[model samples]
Target: MSKKDSAKATLNDLNGKEWVKATKSWFVVNPKPRSAGQANHPAKYPEELVSRFLRFFTKADAWVLDPFAGVGSTLVAAKELGRNAIGVELNGEYVEIGSRHLEKTKGSGRTYLIMGNAHGTLEHLGEIFKDSIPPFSLLMTSPPYWNMLRKSRGGNDSVQKEREASGFDTYYSDSEEDIGNLDDYAEYIDTIGEIFDRLEPILAKNAYLVIVVQNMRDIDGEMKPIAWDLARRLSKTYALRQEMIWCQDNKRLGCWGYPTTYVSNVHHHHCLILQKR
Candidate 1:
């Protein structure tokens, strides 16, 4: 389809992301999924989603970075789309998994996979990315959703400490670099905002920073309206562009009728697409 037609089609879907433009053999899928749930980084994300963001938000040969590179979905998609990609992942095992895949499939585009604490990236990122550094045109990352999606029955206190623990050797050996273990709601926003704050210098002047987060059900099964809170918090730095809805194909089944206060099974997630101004 033509560029104009493609944009129109993309806007038609009310999902978290949409397909934008295509170049060669591949048709890019936008706004990569949150996590692929691999054994290492059980939540790496889908490549199709990453490709779409690269296609529309950036030009060919542009630079992209995934702060919590999880399992390399972002780098894989960026390389495929003819863009340079750098992934900063905390867990060493995941870095191995993602880097190995990147080396095997690398073509004209290059990828740099770093296994370390991403919070301190500013100190040495330039040296490591000096030869490879380009003004990051796009940043598509999904921070840890406060670890609220856990199946355990522990209180919020326990979840925070456990979330930061490295999941490299265990069954759920996943890392939480995107959003570290901040217990309080206020702390969660502050911690994540600080991470984004560090990335400001590396991003291009007008780069787009897109964040994907789903609201969580509290211990009492109440929906915590985090999207609005996050938007308000981030508005201090980034300009809130558009709040897109990512409707999940699968939502929890069953509901109890409350005559006084009631809502429905929340099927959609909030994709807060913000730009650094």
Candidate 2:
């Protein structure tokens, strides 16, 4: 067979791999407990979860990018799987903590964590990657849940209590530049959209962008469909391929509206899969 035919056959085999075939629309994941450094961040995606997605979406030595690199779980996973990774984070403290975690991991891949707001850091990233800036193979991140952390006070839940004891501010940062601190939902969405818009030029053709997000409830007890809204807006730029629901079965039941009303205990996140058009 010709060299091109041989390559096509290998790609066909990869697409038919067992894990790819088994990937369902919805699945349950019980992530292991976080390490002390990882636990410092209020909202952190587990390394195991990130690893699974990485395996499914990319091969060895592929470049991975995470714009909202909260504690760098994605970078850790990328390193372990032999993928070069670049992460951009707004908080300097988190960049420090994430760099420490990357140092402890055993791997042959390269990981770089940049401390800057993702909205304005594309040029910095281009400088860092220089000739290789336009072809990142995968982008995965979980942005702030839209001011949810800022409203965590006065709750009796163990998780809430633990967060209060962490000494870090309840939300991501006090900087007015942080998107999580924005009270206006529309503005928050627009800002996030703009960030992704700027990121578009950096993504390679057919590369995947996975965003882990959930809808939230406001202080006034109204439902905010953040995941759906993001999907609608970002679909303008990237193709909305599909959603893989990450269901959590380990969360304790909350008495959100015990006797007066009914409220859902949102124990799932939308793993939105978007492919560059």
Candidate 3:
């Protein structure tokens, strides 16, 4: 059933955290600790999002892949729910945290952490699997938004900033490990599309790939429509199914002056879901 068709999602999905929704998105709630972006990476999407995807996309002992594992939220979620998880994180610090969290949380033996870039994973992926890389049942991750300076946006721009300082720039461009340093928007989108296009072969016939992304604010001062465009790009490979809205209740409160009018600060996210044929 569509999110609109169901009664409003109840408080929390088996987990204690309250449900979080974005104004215009689809999917369920996922809550987890923030992964600092500067030292770590900003853990934007909630863990509830991860849990819900796990619930709907895979089953017992299924293999899961998170190409951009950042601090291992997906890995943590996968382990918590009993799925085999393989995570690739660019930052050594994040890999450590993800590793530690999994250890402390009683991770399943199937959980494996790879400290590296998502793109380079192409080479190691085959080796990691050994006897033919098993088709992954589910793939979920949030790609870095453009290399926008997150610190400049904080305090002055947000309702709230989690402990993790990681942002698109911090996660991708700022680090030397980024797959391709294409600053151009179209280039970035195309590169991401290509990455996933290549990823299509490794996924199981009926597997699902879900991405969590929001728009970005540029120096030009206009809202970048990254969300809609990404869907169009990925639609070529995976059947872009729906977008889940992840809204935030807490905020620092601020005003965004309109070039022509007035607008209040906004906080929300889009969780795009895709299923492979």
The local distance difference test score of each candidate is 0.67, 0.84, 0.69
RMSD of each: 7.7, 2.2, 6.9
Candidate 1 per-residue lDDT, tens place, 57-172, comes to 77777788778777788888888878888877777778888877787675577788887666776655777856556788888877767755453433334332354464432222
Which digits, one per residue and each the tens of the lDDT, describe model 2 over residues 99-197? 998999999879999988888768878688676674787899999988988876334774767677766446788989888899999999888999998
TM-score for predicted model 2 compared with the true structure: 0.92
Candidate 3, superposed: residue stretches over 4 Å from native: 1-40, 107-109, 154-173, 179-181, 258-264
Q: Against the hidden reference, what TM-scores do the models get?
A: 0.72, 0.92, 0.78
Off by over 4 Å in 2: 1-17, 20-22, 166-169
| lDDT of candidate 3 at residue 219, scale 0 to 100 | 56
**Model 2 lowest lDDT segment of ten:** 8-17
> Rank order by lDDT, top first?
2, 3, 1
| CA shift of 159, model 2, Å | 1.8
Query: Model 3 — which ten-residue stretch has the worst lDDT?
Result: 10-19
Question: Of the pair 1 and 2, which is ahead by TM-score?
Answer: 2
